[model samples]
Target: MEFDYVIVGGGSAGATLAARLSEDPGLSVCLIEAGGRGDGILVRIPAGAVAMLPGYGKINNWAFHTVPQPGLNGRRGYQPRGRALGGSSAINAMLYVRGQRQDYDGWADLGCEGWDWDSVLPWFRRAEGHEDGADAFHGGDGPLQVSHQKAPRPITRAFIAAGQELQLREREDFNTGDNEGIGLFQVTQFHDPARNGERCSAAAAYLHPVMGQRANLTVLTGARAQRILLEGRRATGVEIRRGRRVQQIRARREVILACGAFGSPQLLQLSGIGRPEDITPHGIEMRHELSGVGRNLQDHLDFILAWKTRDTDNFGIGLRGTGQLLRHLARWRRDGRSMAATPFAEGAAFFRSTPQVDRPDLQLHLVIAMVDDHARRLHLGHGYSCHVCVLRPHSRGQVSLASGDPLADPLIDPAYLSDRRDLDLLIAGARQARRLMLGAPLAPYRDRELHGMHDDMTDAEWERHIRARADTIYHPVGTCRMGVDEGAVVDPQLRVHGLQGLRVVDASVMPTLISGNTNAPTIMIAERAAAMILAAARGEDECAGHQAARAS
Candidate 1:
């Protein structure tokens, strides 16, 4: 098969890019996805995330595991990436958080010319169809639906009130460039009458609607890309494995990699496009040398504080809670509004760890249920959880190949808490979260602390508790850094530094991790990248037209 553009991984970036590129009708685009089409019931229901997030059966999750880290007392962390069409956006909590404005401006400061906050804000607006309608900060009509939670639990409101009781200001909007207070998070969900309260994944928003409508677009599910088909330094196509057969899908214009932070780097290294150490060690012949393919790994390492409560307002496995959930499910089917539409991690807050900090350096997610080990371990009865994570950590890690086999999982090492500074910030954040949980507003729901946490615990005790329980809150990026520096894997325009006809549009290209959830920002990146790709194609066509006129 041949097309003008062959995008690998029909996830957030690829789905958005394919839809936008095919808009012209003159260009044909092919999207290759390793998993199913991502339209399953578990993917559509907002509350189905509880079933898929733990990755127990690998339903829509990659369920990758990291190498045991010394920082966490030699513990292996779980990395649950979405395997289907929408990528992690399909299986995530659906929180629509775009990191602080400085996040994008920091990219520009790093020599990524067009990625400053003011420059990239338009792309963010362009991808959003916010419920609040068009405004300077939000778009009225866009592919992705962003909406207020239809029916947040009473406990969620209490959590926000608790933040306020602790002197944290309540912020109704978290996307207004400055997210330095507490509030309920607006989610990426459908609030339209027809599909009210369903998940608005990247595929749901950008890919599924245009599937059969556009003949110029092709979506291949269950097709795993084995390697990039390269001639010298130029990428021409991709070699994929579909079921029992291997096929080559050629690209006439370009081959874009949107396989995300982990997959993008793994595929590049598998195709011999990374550093010699990563490629030649696995018996793969070197195709091109890029040293920054799988370096600069960054993620949000979070620690959760849970309390077992008699309050049944939150979700739990108890008989009473289960009965409540059944009723909510019925209500959701009728009007698409109930606890069935909950994102689970409903309340959110951003704050500084220290008074001297210029911006909020810590973030909190107040879950309306007891969450232990990413929900892999369940506790009986109703309870609540408060998660605190350093918005930006000083530690960095890398992704590398475990073997030459394309099917083998990549070796992931996030090096969590490697720097003492990260631990210090986390310690401070945990203290602040503890204060909020103990505030007057939450006193009615307060019960026994699950992890033996006490109000008078020393800093040393907090450090021990953190090391024993902390893990990732999902966000990961920067494995394929983009900048103008020599170590950058992609240039300012997202093109591979030393390769032609190849570009990577995914979280992997972020020069640094943003301060909040990554799903919204990843979609925004694709929106902007689509514009840049089309503009370049037009430039090439214009140059060819002028050359033909001169010859005639």
Candidate 2:
């Protein structure tokens, strides 16, 4: 099969890019996804995200494990990525955050022109369909849904109140590029009563609505992209595997790689477009010598402070929790407003560890359940946890080829908390969480701290505890960093340097991880990329027309 554009990975960016690019009726686009179509109820329901976490790598997730990080006492961190059409957006906690203004400005500072907050804000607004109508910062008539949970748990309210008691401002919106307050997060959920407030994943909003409807777009599921079929330095097509059949599909114009942080770099390396030293070991002839193809990996290192709770209103285990869930499910079916609509981490706060910092460098996810090790190791009871994550870390890691085989998973090493500052800030963030939890508002329901934590630990003990317990918040980026530097993989236009007819339109191009959830920002990235792609296409068409007229 042939297409004007072939997109690899039908995740958040790929889905959005296909939907936008295919809007031009004259162009043909193909999106290939390695996982199943994201149509399961577990993928749709807002609260069903919990069930998807345990059996992640098996069902709809990649569930990749990292190399034992020396920073975390030789503990291997768990990294779960959505394998379905919507990518991680399908399996993530659906908080609709777009980081701070400086995050994009920081990208501009890194030589990424036209990517500052002011320039990118329009794209962010263009991708959102906010429930609260169009405002200066939000869009009301876009494809993706951004709305509040039907009914927030009382515990979430308590968390907010506790934050207020600590003098933290209560922000009603975090999407405005100023997420420096405690508040309830607006989630990516379609709140239609008919749909029971199901999750509005990237697939649901961008791909599913237009999959078969668009004659110009082709979406292929369960198709694993093996390698980029390159002619000289130009990418001509992709070799893909489906079932036992291997086939090659041609791309007339360009191949856009939207595979997330891990998959994108892995595909690049597998296609022989990485460091010669790295590729030579796999016995594959190197096609390019880009040193930054799989380097600069950054992720938010989070620490969960779990404590047993006395209330059953929040999510938990046991007979009482089960009964509460059943009642909520029935209520959700009737009016689309219930505890079932809540994404477990209902409320959050963004604040600096100290006053000297220019912006909030840390974030908290207030989970209404005892989520330890991504909930793989469950404690037996009703409890809650405050997930403390460093918004920006100085540490970096890399993704490299595990083997020359395309079917093999890439070796992921986030090297979490390798920098001493990362650990220090996390320790500060942990202390802040304890302060908020032990505040007057949340004290009524507070039970003893779980995971053997106590208040009497010294500073040294805190550092030891953080290194022992830190894990990923699953926002990996910067593998295919976009910049003008020699180490950069892609240029500011998102075109891969030293390569033709290829581009990377995904989170992998992010020079730095955003300060919050990555789904919204990634969609924004695709929105900008789509415009650039179309603009370039238009320019080429104009040039072709001019030359044809001259020949005539």
Candidate 3:
């Protein structure tokens, strides 16, 4: 097969780039995805995203488990990467957070030029159409449709009320470059009850809308990229396995890898680009010995504290009983929307764990209603859970190949809370959670029905409970980190460092994780990546260039 560009992974980045590049009608672009087509009901429904977790890897999720982390009591963590068309965004909570200004400035501050917020804000605005309209920090017109919930649950509103009284500062918009907030979240929904029906999936936001119209774009579903076909020193194409047979596709312009963090590094290692010593033992020929190809992994560790509630009220909206589930589903199926997330999470706070930090290091994720573990664990009568995550963890891990075969799962060591400060912040967040519970406003609403955590929550109890049950808040980045630093895999242009005709445009390229959810930022990266690749193909000055991007 031949194309002007061959993109591995029809994920968020791959889908966006394929749609943008093929707009010319002159270039041929092929997008390869490893999972079955995203056709289930849970994927499209915003509230249903949690329900999709279990069924995802069974069909659409890559279902990759991480290597046991010495940091987490030698227990292997479950790292679920989307195998569907929209990638993880298709499976994520769909919170549209762009992170902090410092995150991007840090990229520019450190060798990656053209990556500051000033340069990439246009792309963010270009990809997002915030329902409220344009602002100094937001765009009103873009491919991705970002909207707010029409009818928010009362608990979410109460959460905001609590934040206001606590003096955390309540702002309607978090995307306005300022990090402070206990604001209602603006979700990626279309409208009217906001049941994730019209929410922008990567496929809906980028792929499905532009597929057949562009004859130049060929999207291959369930096609796993085995390796980058490198002819001598340059990447020429990719070898993909479609069903049972291995097929080769050549690229004329570039072979871009948008395989997220896990797949990108795994594919790179399989293609012989990494530490020569590690690659040699896997029976794979060594190419460029980029020692940092699979290092610097990062993730947001969140502690979920769930408590049972008395007097069911609205926290049991979806699960008031089997009776309520039927009623909500009925309304959802008939009208395509419902009063959910409305009165959305009352408030969220970006707080600094330590006084020394310039900005907030911990993000308080508050949910009013009693939802089970992603609704995964059986709902225990009526209960609500709140999630507290350390926004920017200091621990850095790595993603490496355990085997040379692309079919084998990559070795992912997120090194969660490897930094003691992270644990301290989590403990601090627990303290804050207790404070919120004790706040006069929540005293009536929060009965502390579950976990026996109502009265006298102590520091020792918070620390012990937090360490025992803390899990991911779902932001994983920096594996194939983009920078002009030592062994950086890609430059600010998202192009592979020291490699020709190759680029990685996904969460994998983030030098560090942002302060919020990665869904919006990941999409923003794709939008910028598409524009840069298109500019480069047109012989124009692309934002990211090789000569100026070499690691110092």
The backbone clash count of each candidate, in order, is 0, 0, 14
lDDT of 3 by residue, 105-188 (tens): 888887888888776677777777677787767777677778766556656667677767877787778786677768777777
RMSD of each: 4.0, 4.1, 3.8
- Write down the lDDT of every candidate, Cα atoms only: 0.91, 0.88, 0.75
| Model 2 TM-score (2 dp) | 0.96
- How far residue 174's Cα lies from its native spot in candidate 3, in Å, is 0.6
How does each model score on TM-score?
A: 0.97, 0.96, 0.93
Best by lDDT: 1
- RMSD of candidate 1 to true structure, Å: 4.0
lDDT of 2 by residue, 471-526 (tens): 88889999999999999999988999999999999999999988998889999999
Encode model 1's per-residue lDDT on 368-422: one tens digit a residue: 9899999999999889999999998999999999999999999999999999999
Worst ten in a row by lDDT for model 3: 543-552
Error of 1 at 391 (Å): 0.4
Clashing pairs in 2: none
